[model samples]
Target: MITNETKENYNQCQNVNCSTTFVSHETVARYIIKPQLINVLIPNG
Candidate 1:
């Protein structure tokens, strides 16, 4: 479920080697806010 009470959500993957916190250069990011978690689209590669 989603509620409209979130201040900040980090969808960045757990990839420590991701290089950057937020990468909007190549792939498209789809932000999804849930009850207790945030989801975002990331490149499969």
Candidate 2:
């Protein structure tokens, strides 16, 4: 692990044949709509 935080994480591959690094993000929704509301807006036949 290179860096770790509440919202984001940074990591690197640990292989002799690989040199890959990446960052991952954590997120939360500010607001959510119910499934029923989604169905009302976008009906499925």
Candidate 3:
């Protein structure tokens, strides 16, 4: 299950004996340095 307020995903174990629950936080990474154009040089054959 995902929550909109905290933007986190909740995961629970199906096993009734364990019943372990885990929460994952979701986040977006902002690009500090954008992709730069690459130049490729081919050798004459």
Candidate 4:
């Protein structure tokens, strides 16, 4: 259920375990958006 609007929320993963913070549209798009789109891609996964 990821959307361009929902993408605005939780802008940071804050991977404290890894001591990293992904904070950018492109970064989020790659790590988050692509995965969701994969499942929703009409052809199916």
Query: Cα RMSD for candidate 4?
Result: 10.3
lDDT string for model 4 (1-45, tens) is 255534333355557776555544322334443444345457756
Query: Per-prediction RMSD in angstroms?
Result: 16.1, 8.7, 7.1, 10.3
User: What's each prediction's TM-score?
Assistant: 0.19, 0.39, 0.36, 0.17
* lDDT computed for candidate 1: 0.50
3 or 4, which is superior by TM-score?
Answer: 3
Pairs of residues clashing in candidate 3: none
List the global CA lDDT of all models.
0.50, 0.65, 0.76, 0.45
Residue by residue across 1-45, what tens digits does model 1's lDDT show?
133432343357677888356533333255585357668889998
Worst 10 residues of 2 by lDDT: 31-40
Q: Pick the candidate with the highest lDDT.
A: 3
Roughly what TM-score does model 1 have, to 2 decimal places?
A: 0.19
Q: Please name the candidate that would achieve the greatest TM-score relative to the true structure.
A: 2
Clash pairs (backbone) in predicted model 4: none
Runs of candidate 2 with Cα error greater than 4 angstroms are: 1-6, 28-45
